[model samples]
Target chain A: MKTFFLSDGDLDEFVTNLIAKSPVFAPVAKKTRFVFNQLESVEDLRLDYDTTILPPKKLFVPTKQDLVTFEHGKYEECLAPGKKILFGVHPYDIKAISMMDWIHEESNFDIYYHSNRKATTIIGSNVQNHYKKAFFGSVCKELKVMGHDMFLTKIADGYLVEVLTKKGDDLLPDGNFTDVSKEQIKNAADVNTKADENCPSKLKNTSLEIKHKIRMYYDSDVWKKKSENCFSCGSCNIVCPTCYCFDIQDEWALEPTSGKRYRRWDACLTCEFSEVSVQGGSENFREERAERFRHRIMRKTSFLNDKLGGPACVGCGRCSGTCTADIADPVSIINEIMEK
Target chain B: MSCSSNHDKNIFLPKNAIIRKASQMTAFETHFTLKMEDESEFIYEPGQIVEAGLFGYGEIPLGLSSSPTQQGSFELVVREVGKVSKALCALKAGDTMTIRGPLGKGFPVSEFVGQDVLIVAGGIGLCPTRSMIRYIMDRRDEFKDFKLLFGARSPDELLFEDDLAYWRCSSDVNYLETVDKPNDRWKGNIGVITTLFEGIDHLDPATRVIICGPPIMYKFVIAQLAKYNISEHHIFVDLERRMKCGVGKCGHCQINDKYVCMDGPVFRYSDIKDLEEAI
Candidate 1:
């Protein structure tokens, strides 16, 4: 784990070089918010911003991905994107990606997700700014600088670049550098502590406790009351990094002999998400809006945690920020349940 | 069962299978016997399901209706319910379809040996249970007392009529049936499946009851079984859910924390009794 000091100009040069060789995705300003987009140049990279509109998960599991293409009876698995680099990811988003990795690996071994993950190089940056709604500080105590190829921490004049992997070593800038002394490490730690403290929201209970509380309140009227204004727009699911539920369909070309089978992101909040009609047109499951609401919360805090060993919600607060009905915030929801 | 083929190894990929025979069982249901293109045996347990479909249309999970003892081919009794099943019903003999299976946990027939077997099936729910019934019939000497109780909305909706008649005449097997609304030709019991259990003289404590039906039927059947003093551990149930990927990645088939595709399409009643979504 070698650390180097790079000037602001040197950091820009390194990003420019990396973009020149391969595709580089970094956060850029999108009106009032930020989004992860392909960096045409170093000018678009926004390392000083708060959280992006969507997590870096879209880089691996895109909204719609082709699983296979078929011609009559034969089919071939679709190829994933080539080698690319994702830059300026925050620690919480990195944790979400790791959770997705565990989920895709432990279950069916999703080759589509794994192939994209292998191709993409993750470069995480320390959060210099915090979103007003984000509660990662309270629930994400274990968040650290790991699961990334390189981690960049802001120092006085430039950036403290810590190359953490072999792929990271290749992206190192050829410039004058100094070993990160104990004092520099302490400074980085201080910055992280300050960032954590700056987070405005907090959860009163651990995720495990929240999970148990959810089971106790499984049939509570709180779900119906809280979700009364829900439009079922599913913005909460669309922006979630750990929401990996999808619907698979096959599309035929003009020639019926050839077609493509693909999967697109699906939301549990939607009315028809779990509707399966048997003979005589009778749907068997998940018919109520309140049940759907409870399902989304349970999936984030309890159901997925039971399977993946961690909460699916990373407390990034994108769902709450994007919710039109002023619901879908895990921190508020869990806090309300804990209060009861 | 040589397990050397690429399609057999990959959980996602479907192997090319041809329909060796096909017939309409009822107005809505069709029966098909499918064999791999290479003529390899599609080995599967009685309660497991297969992902079956055409290339243009997507796949859906269908419970395997044939016994494992039957080699070289497997059977599926598909009701023309949805898009995938409608397409499957349209196929005929020699028609090509893709299959990836047999997925999920099947019935534990080996553990039922020397025990009185009680089977309860309702409507098209009889499809998965037929495999188990056929398996038990093939190895009849291995098990002790056998009882089959079937219920349908009407005589028209009843499945496997020939097999039902055979079991009715077999001295070693006790077969009883009922319908919700009887017609002019109907002369048997006219009630729900639970009513068939009322006259039973004895429900052996060692009986392993396998039950399959729509969600509504489970409550009534399980309650009746409880009256007979059948312990939860001795009762096995096959649950049905909307499944996309039978290997468990797709979340469609999950019931609470359990993925029905992986943890089971079949589970011992005791194992899933506490799961609110299961029953």
Candidate 2:
């Protein structure tokens, strides 16, 4: 509801104090890129980083975590919540996390996800630097996740912090900071708009012909030729913020009596992902690597058009970045299909 | 839409259903007649299925064999191939099982009223077809003619012997049964059920054919129906998929873009001919 401008010196002091007081995670420079980790020093908070090595989804849904543990015919699931703060998130990654929030809340609400989500206080920042591969600003106008409690934008001399939720209001006391002058607000808005304008390529202006041509190119030879290098390691799916497919497994104890039942993330790119309980599963579905390649595109664009309102892909570019074969970019596939 | 303070929102939770009757038809198959505690009607269409379970073990999808027209008690004929089914078959009459269902899209019988009906079932796939068979028998006066054809691996595996005998006595209904192999005591037709179509003129081109059974039986039966110049829309079938969560969320039992649990376990041939995952 209210905004305040903190000077560069004050910004450092504020971050240092927060890190010392709370369990805070911030973007730290990792080789050529940045990653979210425990903020040991104030300087490690890379406010100008374009993107992180991994999106902040790991905080909500960990890469490898137990769903629940059980013993002796009694089952107890832990949908535990914790208190923490995540700082310096880019708009695109923030948008991806918010989309996951909606999915976990709708219909069959996931208790495990919701609990962790409620405990975390998100402090998102406007993108000051653009990753070359990012096209999200054009697709969805990369804006602050309205769901986040506290949001920050970099201005000329300092950072402009906006308090949007009760959690944000709690962080800011009565006399925390003075007025966010009109000049500061105007300058912050200008920098944010300039960043958005520079993010998307000129290709965003053209009409996409991918969907119509993809229908015709379902049996095309291009996919087969291109997908020959795929190893089916499913690394792309593991890194993606939107790939939510999973497999359920039940584990009995060494005594063969009682144990835990849990679900783990699964990827369609893997051979065993679509296997049926019965014999002779649909090898036809994933017979060729190209079919699997094209099916992922169809699931994001068309199948989602019928089920969920929008395409499932948020244009985050995580799949393309994670793919070892350099053939997973749906945008390039879309363009090629359209041209054909 | 029916949210209330007293009403529990969990549809996945099972109600206590006691197995009132259990009969062993084949070495690998058993029929369990279950009745719920509330005594409310578990009203559902012909091809819908229910999830039955033992408390600490697990659950499996079992097709509803009894018709919705016959309420109070429902029946499921399960072939014991997996762990859950094998555990289910071990239970005798008066055993309790938890059940949640009457789920999924079932065959549209109202659309087939007053038209000639062709019913075909193969092996253990006859369970869902039995629902339609019983329904058609009850409402026999509303239809023109009824033809039933069933095929199993052998004569000893045929389900519902008493009901089959009663149908044989009915004047409006003509039933033909076949097995892959005929033993010394066998006196009926011996071959695939498709062969029983020879010289049989019971169905008009306007007749609606409802067939269910194993996945392998569908294409062959469809080819025979097409030989009679029947339109794809006139033929309906039920599908079996690995269904868990009976609601669409579990992500199993999907056929292309459709969820078999919600969009259909029953669908017209024309509706899903283009779907790659469909049989």
Candidate 3:
């Protein structure tokens, strides 16, 4: 628990030194929201932000990743790692990534994902600004502690940085900062307590209750009426912090003799997501629009909890914010389930 | 832990296999004999599927039809029903394809060795059960009796004609086949796969029954098998789902907490009878 404090000026100096040395990825301004991007300068980083359009999971399990390359009746697996610094990760997002890590490495273990994850350094920051629907603290107390090489908390006039790993210790430039005092430690704890108090009034850890309500309403007609406007656009999946479904494909060169096999992010919201060779599609089991809608919610509530200890939703509010049909808000759906 | 050892222990990815032999058994279907790059044998029990992929194309779950006793290569009977299989059917001999499997939990062959085995296959469902048929033949001395009740839509739709002929001639096996619609030359039973089970002799209560087919076939076949007094534990079925990652990471293959790719593509009927999604 190596703790240090840096003034706003010193923070800029540290950011500049870190960017010059390694590839640092942090949130940058996009239109009205923010997105994780490679930091080129101190000014490019946003230390105080609500949430990014995409979670930091993309840094490890990318949208499109090459699995192997084959040619001329021979095949060689290509597994590469990217050296990076994942910056500005909120605790909820970190919690989501940790769950994903467990899933990818649990049974069979994914070499591609595990290798990429090893080469990256994770830097987490306290949530100074919470999304309107954010409620992860109640679900898992994720805001208090998470898996990160480094954690940063905003204080009155400076930032309290806690280095949790050797990789985090290596990121310090000049290594000159005010030593942590008792008062500074108390300030860090107060900031975290305030963040937990900021959750929306409707949000609660009644997750098991939500699961029961969802099961009771599995056959309800309200889902059909609510999901009628969906175009199966898959925006909810694309923006979700925990959705990890992918589609693998081969890309042959123009000559058709050789190519690389790769996998890209896929979504159940898409019509062809369930297409297979034996039967064209198995999603027919849940063919109705309403059924698909309920299934996604069921995944976040019951299925993921059964598999990974708790719900997969980090309560980041990205799904609700990105849905075009205006019916993808998970909190609203949970609220409706609770009403029953 | 060291990063290298962590990665070395995580090589569960599918390997590329070559199509050593291929044939169009039906107008819409083709059977491919696949061999791994390293030439290692694909040792899998009957009623398992591999994630077969055509490079530059896509992937789909195809049942393993060849017996594991046959070393160095395995067989998959592919139907050109979708984009991936359509591409697979277009490939010829000597062409290379990618695959990852022996993935799902296959049939409990060890548990059924000395008992009577009743196999019911419907339409193309005969593809998976073919593995069990070949296994029983390879180790004929170990089993008590072999009975095959298979059905398809037409004579042309029946899979592995040569193999069926071999099973029909074996003394230890009682083989019967039917087609839903018959031609003038056809002289066998004329009904669904379930109807053929009615004419078969009494099966022991310890007899193990294996079924593979569309969801609609299970309800009828299991009901008919139930009359033979076989307990649910003695009954097994292979349930196929759309699987992308055969390692169980992908949610597409899920039926409740069970991922058809890992937990099972094969299951004891007693274990999954309560699973509403399974027939």
Give the Cα lDDT of each candidate.
Answer: 0.85, 0.73, 0.79
lDDT of 1: 0.85
Which of the two candidates, 1 or 3, achieves a greater DockQ against the reference? 3
Most accurate candidate by lDDT: 1
How does residue A259 of candidate 2 score in lDDT?
A: 60
RMSD of each: 2.8, 4.4, 2.8
Candidate 2: what lDDT? 0.73
Candidate topping TM-score: 1
Residue range A295-325, candidate 2, lDDT tens digits: 6777655564433344556666767777888
DockQ, per-model, please? 0.42, 0.23, 0.45
lDDT of 3 at A118: 81
Q: Write the per-residue lDDT of candidate 2 for residues B1-279, one digit (tens) a residue.
A: 111222223444566677889999777778888888667667778888888865445677777999988878889987777667777889999887767687888889887899989999998778888888888888888887889888987878878888878876878688888999888898989999899999486458888898887777889999999878888998888888767657665555666677787777888999998876587
- Total clashing residue pairs per candidate? 0, 0, 1
Q: Which pairs clash in the backbone of model 1?
A: none
